[model samples]
Target: MDRRTLLTLGLGGGVAVLALGAGVAVRQVMESRRAARVTGTKLGAPFRLTDHNGQPITEAAFQGRPSLLFFGFTHCPEICPTTVYDMETWLSEMDVAPEALGAYFVTIDPERDTSEFLKSYLEPQSHRILGITGEPEAVWDMAKSWRVYFQKRPLDGGDYTMDHYASIFVLNARGEVVDLIPYGTAADEAKAKIAAVL
Candidate 1:
């Protein structure tokens, strides 16, 4: 190859790398800012809901232990499962005792995500995570209290999908939300934050 052509190709490759790096940096910053917005804000309140088993469950049930709470519907194609798995893996790596750590999956779409649906949907999680759902008003009230953003968008075939906050609420043992852990957090960082609560 000619010297000029070789140099140009090298520069193009460098530009691509720089562009990718910049995109990553920007995303990290955005996620950090989003996390900051929700942190230091008192979250979670006394709210009544039901678990995937059709039994009553309350927010106070998470008290006496630090908990990781995520608000998403089971129908989510990617983000919901990915976030749950990531959080679960982080918890496992931290070696958090099941008693010391309460992990919950709260569904924002209660209409379609019935108790049976949630039970089957999370069966693969080995039942490690508890799924919460209830009447629309009850669920939405809990989401609003937690300041979680979620909305349902109708699909083509009379079905719908849920868009929700991708961050997990980190609650202290007293059940007070102490931090917002953003999606894709470095596992080491996640472990450190979770360990502090444990």
Candidate 2:
């Protein structure tokens, strides 16, 4: 072949090799992620925090029982309370025994959501749903570990509000993330997801 033809062929072969390598890399990553999902590997890091009753708790609390976790602040005007109520309804409809499941409302606003405050805020809604809060840094660290997002939004007055993830994390008995029931999911759909972990 001429020099021009030889050069073109060499460039084309190089591109083909690069494309093959890229495809292999992508497949490996996809397979790894699929294996993680299938094996139900632990998705959140360990943490130490206090329950609503002022008792110390750890990630170990999630082990040995299916659990549901959601991140929100009590001061939230609408979504937080509504989500908690939805959680109660789903569990009740599913006939999930209180002892058979672990449901936690973890505070994204630790500055205002103390253990006592969480207790009072949660008591009337559902006895089965527990509250979790801790030092601001610790709470934020735990939230980060769980891949939760939150930010403070300034209001006209001196007060402020929080914007945060509103989905419920469904975890299996091994603390593996089974699914996330997004905000506004239908009650029946939520029940089905939670039932899977149970």
Candidate 3:
């Protein structure tokens, strides 16, 4: 190739690389902003739900104490049960007073997970963790306010299952989200995050 043509091609390639690099940087900044927005979101939206004990509860209940909030249903074949077990283990290991850390399991499948059913489902897992359920609209509204994503999936025999966000939310006394411990996080790491909020 001619010298001028080679020079032109080299310059074009360099410009392309720089443009690509700039695009990547812009994308990274946008992602960072999105992450900030998610973390800055206020939690504890208004809702009236029944606890496992059939007692009325609201967003007010989350105030005045640090909490570990998890969203799942009793019928989950794996993640839900495993997370419950992990939560129970973490709380036991932390040795925190029961009243000190309010651990809750909010059901996204309220259609089938009633207050009574939740009581039975959670009893074996850990009394330390309470279950929350209510009318479908109210339950889903609460979840939506917290940015939880849950959708129903049809199964065989006309049954249905839930696809949901499976993470433990650690919140401070005022119910502001401190950190999210994703499913299958290391026990020590999860405990550290929970303890930080507490």
Candidate 4:
């Protein structure tokens, strides 16, 4: 190629690299701002639901303590289990027992996650966490109020699965969402967010 043409090509490549870098930086900043927006936005609302124990409860039950809430179904194969494990691990390292934080394992699939099923599904949690499930309408009300995403999809042989937001929702002592702990966040990051209000 001619000398001028070669130089032009090199400069174009450099410009492309710089533009890509700028785009990445912009995305990072936007993501941070979005996280902060969700943090400051009020979330959670009143709902009377049945716990794994089959007792009726309302949002009032979770009042007066910081809560680490997760919405997933018992039948979830991967994301649900992984997120729960991460949150449990993060809280295990906390000086406070996980239960003290009012941990909740709310099932978004009420049709399948009956109170009896929820009891067995959470047995591994050793009663440290409460599982919430009730009528579909009540569950939808709770999920909708929090802006949590959840939808059921049918699979082969008439089976189905739940698609939901898997992040761990952090509520301050008064039940206002203060931050969202993304799934797989570093333990220190989760701890810092929880500790800030504890």
Candidate 5:
């Protein structure tokens, strides 16, 4: 082959290689971002609480499976139940085995959400949807450890309202926090994210 022809071919091959490398890099970056959006953080501090059955539960209960956790009270009129319902629907649609995942509802209003109340309230939900509550001090400590915010507001009828942060925590099989989905996360998106982890 002529020298000029050989040189041209070499340059063209180099350019193609570079283009492929660039494409791969872009794809990797996109995938990372998607994973981050689906799973917020990868570390979860330890926590201990009482299950709806009044049994002592801890992060240990979540070992060997991914846990979808949310912090709210049974009395929450709108956001709490709606988010739980969405998670339930999304989890039901997932192809994961039943033993591969769990759902936990941690109550911020430990004062009002007794074991009996939680059991009655969550009866209609899936059995996988476990409810947890504990002493107010311990519950608050756990909330802080999870970086969740909550407060109590007084009402005029000699009652009170509890306002708590609303975010879904996704934990991996080893009981480590992997990601967080906000309250408005779409059902399809949640399912896709969970499927990715599974």
Candidate 6:
């Protein structure tokens, strides 16, 4: 081969290598961003709470399977039920098997949400959706451990409303908090997030 031809081939090969490297780097960055947006924080934070069955639920229950946990009460007319329904729908649509993922509804209004009530409420939604409720103090302690916030507001009719943060937590198989999906997250995005972790 001529010297000029050899030099041209060498330059072309180097350019191709660089382009491939750039493409790989771009793909990695995009995946990282998608994961971050889906799960807001790192997993493995020690969290203790009660399960809907009145059992002593802890982070350990979330172990062995990926979990999607939402902290809200059954009384939440808008955001709580809506988010649960969305998650159920998305999970049903997923190609993954149900055994690979778990869903939880942790109540902020423990005083009002008994185990029976929780079971009744979630029965129609999903058999896999576990409901958790405990003493007010225990619930508060768990909320504080997870950096969740909630408060009760008294109404004029002597009733009260429980105000709480609405964010879905995605925990990995190891029971670590891997990520968070903010309220109003689309079904597709939520499903994508859960699938990524699983």
Models 1 onward score TM values of 0.76, 0.82, 0.80, 0.77, 0.75, 0.74
TM-score of candidate 3 to 2 decimals: 0.80
Model 3 lowest lDDT segment of ten: 9-18
lDDT score at residue 34, model 1, on the 0-100 scale = 59
lDDT tens string, model 5, 1-198?
Answer: 664442221322221111223223334544676676743243335777899988999878778888888888887777777777887778777755567888889888999998889988886876768898988898878876666667787767898766566667777887656666766677778787687667
True-structure lDDT of candidate 5: 0.70
Question: Candidate 3 — what's its lDDT?
Answer: 0.77
Best by TM-score: 2
Question: What digit string (tens of lDDT, one per residue) describes model 4 on residues 1-198?
Answer: 564442221321221111223223334544665676743335567889999999998998667888888888888776666666776676777766754688888888999999999898786854567889999999988977776766676777998776666667787777766676765578888899888768
Model 6, runs deviating above 4 Å: 1-49
Question: Considering TM-score, which of the candidate structures 3 and 6 is the better prediction for this target?
Answer: 3
lDDT of 6 by residue, 129-178 (tens): 89988778887677656656566867669987676666787888866566
lDDT of each: 0.71, 0.78, 0.77, 0.71, 0.70, 0.69
Which segments of model 2 are wrong by more than 4 Å? Answer: 1-32, 35-37
Better of 5 and 6 by lDDT: 5
lDDT tens string, model 1, 1-198?
664442221321221111223223334544665577743334557888899888999977778888888887887766677777887788777776777788899998898889999999886763568899999998999887776666666667887666556677777777766665766678888788788788
State the lDDT of candidate 3 residue by residue for 111-183, as single tens digits. Answer: 9999999999999889899999999999999988876767786777998777666677777788876667767
Pairs with backbone N, CA or C atoms under 3 Å apart (clashes), candidate 2: none
Lowest lDDT 10-residue stretch of candidate 6: 9-18
